[model samples]
Target chain A: MEGDAAGIMDKSINVLIVDDYRTMLRIIRNLLKQLEFENVEEATDGREALAKLRAGNFGLVISDWNMQPMTGLDLLKEVRADPRLKATPFIMVTAESKTENVIAAKQAGVSNYIVKPFNAETLREKIEKVLAHA
Target chain B: MPDGLRGRGASAAAAPPPPPSAEAIEAAVRAVLGSLEGDLTAKEAALLAELEALGRTVRRVKAEIAALGVEDITASHIPSATDELDAVVEHTAAATNEILDCCETLERLEPQLGGEGQAALRGAITRIYEACSFQDITGQRIAKVVAALKAIEARVAAVVGTVARVAPAADAGGAAASPAEAAAGARPPPTEGQALAQGPQLPGAGVSQDEIDRLLASFD
Candidate 1:
């Protein structure tokens, strides 16, 4: 548990980020790279994210809330419901910091909730908090 | 001759005065209508009621707009107008990030520069890097603006949908496909916890980040 935060910076840990915005995906990828985690994957939306999650063995999942057809909350619910992916650490990143959204994500069994416009340090802290439990 | 002249004069005098002209009649009708302005016709009455309801809706929207921290929906307040603002902000952020990347490259090449040049370059790059950090702060504020716009947009859509639904007589422009309905349909079915999803909050509007963290931590 103590070494979990340090272990997150390990180059081997595969992180998957799901967002509809290309700019956001790039920003998150850069932040993850800055933290020395290079094995990052990207998905455009929840549907794509689910497929990627099934195909890859990822250490952590970071997703945005507002999306078309399938939202991050729905994705989280699906993740929690799946037998193979139920234990995966999932972080929901969104511009919406609404109490309701946070509560919904929590009820869906999200590992962490991050408000957008956040810095890389904040991202690291959130990832560390979730990854520590893993 | 004198009898005929007298007969002609009598006949001319027997002709009565003419009725009012078309322009004078039109003026009179207009005056009557102006007087009856308060007493609308049946169709006009229905339209008036709709207009009054619309006024009320506008007032409610005005209050909502004020709540968004903007007194008026000027050209800048419109959603499309903000698209440019969003693009500019994104561009600025991208530029800032690129500058930071350049600074990183400079840091890597620092060892090759002479001692004095290295120190000078490092100072310049550090300043530039610090300046680039402004993107984070601007990004936060912009996020708030965008959130406020979304709220306004939702309220506006609801108002429009209501207006459209109310006017069944005018088939030409009914609110058949309400933006509000579309927005609602795009989301998941409401759960008890769904009510808690408030979009981006204004500063000091709700619980702090620490409180949210604690709340989530206590979930288990």
Candidate 2:
């Protein structure tokens, strides 16, 4: 158990990336890995991601703003609604660029918003910014 | 206008008649020539002075005609729209398969990730991220790739959304093929993105044997 934890601690800090696109979530996970963030998770939608968030102690939530049934904003709302996860940093990594959407996300308590098609460095920056402030 | 050639031929036939004889003709000619004589004489002198001008025109026209010599203009052909579509289709299909293959590899490795432990999980994720070209880069680079992928996605989306293109496939045999029923044809597998949404990832070392079994089973 100590060996397991030592290995785990060597690459700690769980990160959950939620996006409908598998390639994109994998990309975000990989980007986090490059930042030495080995503990990463991917959820396809808001509901499933929310379930994982409820179950795990993720340091951050990187999600797409536009999705079916439940969006990143919905997950943000859910995270904010939950008493246990309200303080958890939620950064929306998505393709939404509209002013209203940003404003709405801000209102719903989003830690940050990253317009999609971002690179590993931008992702790293956003992650660092979120974790630093968190 | 086709018959107008006769009028030109007729004028050419009457071209031999000379003026300067009959009083009426001479008077009429002299009257007009009287006013234009000075300019006419100057023109004649200039023509004599520049006799090479006509030669120059003929030479220029000959050069132009030589330059206009005909050859095969269609030798270097621009590819047809269908050819371009075929190329794009081939590329899209290959990229899709590569993406699917990467996902399958990830699934196969999930069990092994357990044997190597969490470190292996990290290693597998690392492999995936690298294979997908998702490491040590800038947002700009990722954006460029994503933009290109999105453009391609848009084209594929358009193809997928096209009722006419799909409809033609059903009618190729001259039989009415309803797309609703014709949908039974095997479509391309879901992209890696779609697979991640629904599949179990990183099952850990507990399923190492199962992972090996699955990998071995896939050989058949």
Candidate 3:
């Protein structure tokens, strides 16, 4: 629950995947699983994600751009606005790859960004980049 | 209404959402654009945000359909797709602008999103990942989605074929219309279809080899 990526870390990393789409969530989990990051969890959206975050210690967050009640952006801002969760690196998985969204996410303090329909390497590269920068 | 009839399509209830067309797609986009156009009042924004979410779902569905090589179905559903798409793009523009607005707001208040507020936000970001990254287990990004769409296309084509087939039998006994004509008649009007065919032409609409090549450029 509290480690960085294995190839990245000496041990494993705890990652949380948040998206309303079950398939997308599965896809991301499978991607991270490929990277050997075994300690991962899933949440349907931000509200549940908040619950899990409160319940456990997580290392990295890879979240969708859109979701109900709270979006990944909102969650990002919320995390930034909160004391307990700030400073944790967050990456966004977005279908909307427009320049504006990326700049906004960056300003909001996202660790990095990846467009949706992304593969293992794009994901791994982004995660590694974020961790290294952090 | 018959006893056996009830079980005939009983399996349909468990089917994944039927690509979200008609009323569903309409309602989604309307909410989407409404949310985006600054048309939503304070309370309406919340509801519209939800609609924008649905628009994303619908778009993803269209993407799936496109991947399946079922161009006809996409063409047939073009009205709903275009409407939903227009709404989504517009709404997303709005939301992205909103995020921009908020960042400006934050900057005016504090240059940095500091304190515990920042901590929780960062934590939430990390945890959300553990929940959603299954889309890329090993590497293949488009493979699973492509596979799922192929299966659905097979199912939908089968259903459409069955529907088309049923009409021929109906026409066989003294009916005059050919199956194509019957198929044509069963559909709603042609206005939307016509507009779609004649619509903005999507730059490179079809999933041609070039487009596939562009998408696969990374892996290749």
- For each candidate, give the TM-score of chain B: 0.42, 0.23, 0.23
Which 10-residue window in model 3 chain A sums to the lowest lDDT?
Answer: A1-10
* Pick by lDDT: 1 or 2, better one: 1
Summarize candidate 3's per-residue lDDT along B83-155 as a digit string, tens digits: 5545654554455445434533443444267898766654443344433332332113233344345455445
Model 2 misplaced regions, further than 4 Å: A1-11, B1-220
Q: What is the lDDT of residue B169 in candidate 1?
A: 24
Summarize candidate 2's per-residue lDDT along A9-111 as a digit string, tens digits.
3237788888766656656665665567778888988889999998888877888865545777877888999999998888876555444455566777887
Q: Estimate each model's TM-score.
A: 0.57, 0.40, 0.39
Please identify model 1 stretches exceeding 4 Å from their true place: A1-11, B1-83, B86-90, B93-97, B100-198
Clashing residue pair totals per candidate (backbone < 3 A) = 6, 5, 60
TM-score of chain A of each: 0.93, 0.88, 0.89
lDDT of each: 0.68, 0.55, 0.57
What local lDDT score does residue B28 receive in model 1, on the 0 to 100 scale? Answer: 55
Task: Give one digit per residue, the lDDT tens place, for model 1 in B1-220.
Answer: 6999888878878963333332334445455445557667898777656655655665566456446644234224566757866997889877876776786788678779979999898667645543554564466567667767776766654443333322232122323334555667797686432344344566766555676688898897
The alpha-carbon deviation from the true structure for residue B202 of candidate 2, after best TM-score superposition, in angstroms, is: 37
lDDT of 3 by residue, A1-134 (tens): 12344245522667888976665665576557656688999998777887788777888888876665667777787778878888777988765444445556666777877765455666777687677655
Model 3 error, position A116 (Å): 1.2
RMSD of each: 18.7, 22.5, 24.6
